[model samples]
Target: MMLYIIDSIRTNNFHGEQMMGKIRTLWENASRKLEHHQNNVYGVYNDYESDYRGDYSLSIAMEENNGEAFIEITSSEKYKVFQVDKTDEQGMFKTWSKIWKQEEIGLLERAYTYDFEKYGPNGEIEIHIGAV
Candidate 1:
């Protein structure tokens, strides 16, 4: 499906540049730019130049285009889903840490196409990693 992205950035996990700070700012700006009415919002990783270690773009998006920038992300047949409790402030990062660890050890064969985080309406979360 296609996602209407509120904001976007190109960054990589390597290189001294911080992903969290940039992502936080992107979401901050996006929240101010549009009126969100979706049951869930998505953090979509796309435009992959290579694998997870390579540069990619992250967008805060929803189902409707609403004249905003958008990207197409489809659900794959195989995935690794990580659930995060809404109350844990660091749950998001911790889940990502676990994902990276698995990828580092050859546990995750990534698709390098689209990975997304679903922020549920009830405040729960699921990090979906595309698998090859």
Candidate 2:
């Protein structure tokens, strides 16, 4: 089994609408064998801060002759893409908003291969977000 944790920072549509909506494209890999779903973060807010943090933790149970699964994280806004490696045992990929230079809100991600012996308990990855 493999798990992909996608974290989306404070996001809003052009009309300034504030809500957490699932982006279908990101789950393209598991579309065929998607066994179950667990939406960790949905319809949330952070009025106290300038940004919001939301995550979609999808779990894919292994099947017979399965190759591999992938995790894709994207934003409707324009921003750059930076690489934030995992710095702790949590395997968190951190992102910053201010660094984005394009129309896309930057994405920082890290992936782990499932090795039950090494990674243990169905490879799980964490993502961390911060202000730009």
Candidate 3:
């Protein structure tokens, strides 16, 4: 998969920008800039210093490069997918918490590559975690 970035932030979930609303703010700003797209937005996670507990680069991106920064994932790569519950107000956060817990317990092996959240045009959402 290849994506063009609208905005990016370097952050870790613990003792980082998440609690300070940086993630939320990035998404908000990116959302506005993405209005001309096809309604499909991606939240890309990459450049992991270590793992989820470490700082990583997160970008709001789309398939059309639009002359912006971009990331590409190998075609044969694998991922552990988490479908978001659109009805849950804390759906994204809850799902991410689950991913971290699963990884910690050895239930999931993360690749620390290019993970992504796909927000589809039809309101469906899924998180694709790069897997080993």
Candidate 4:
């Protein structure tokens, strides 16, 4: 899949609950002035300062020929996909945190590249972790 996204930088160090709050706020603001062409939105992290902090960029889906300014992202390679159901009261980020804490399974994240979240229409979330 391909995405045409509006970019922003998130530099806060908040983790867990605090991070989720910030993420909601960020998505609200990022999408406020934009139009949604698809049911799924994406949050792409291109630069990682550490495990839980980085320059986070949010983007809504758009057509390839849409005459708007956007960063184009294409899912051309294999990535590890993690799902968060809409029915889960704890939400996507919290579920991600829990997954991140499980290091014994040996699923190493490719932090050098971009990682992203695909938010579905039914509120389901598919987190694509860049993997080596």
Consecutive 10-residue window with the lowest summed lDDT within model 3? 11-20
Clashing pairs in 4: none
Residue runs of model 4 more than 4 Å from their true location after superposition: 13-22, 34-36, 53-69, 72-76
RMSD of each: 2.0, 12.9, 1.4, 3.7
lDDT tens readout by residue for model 2, 47-118: 222222322232333322343543333343232233333454422212323322221444432221111111
lDDT of 3 at 51: 82
Identify the leading candidate in terms of TM-score.
Answer: 3
Better of 2 and 3 by TM-score: 3
Candidate 2 whole-model C-alpha lDDT, 0 to 1? 0.29
Give candidate 2's total backbone clashes: 10
What's the lDDT for residue 35 in model 3?
76
Number of clashes recorded per candidate: 0, 10, 0, 0
lDDT of 1 by residue, 1-132 (tens): 778877788988776288778978998887775455656788898888887778898888887766357777655457789998668888887888899899999999888778899887777899999888
Total backbone collisions, model 1: 0
Which residue pairs overlap in candidate 2's backbone? 10-52, 77-104, 77-105, 78-103, 78-104, 78-105, 79-103, 79-104, 79-105, 98-132
- Model 4 lowest lDDT segment of ten: 58-67
Model 4, span 29-49: residue lDDT tens: 766644554556777766566
- Give candidate 3's TM-score: 0.92
State every prediction's TM-score relative to the real structure. 0.85, 0.20, 0.92, 0.68
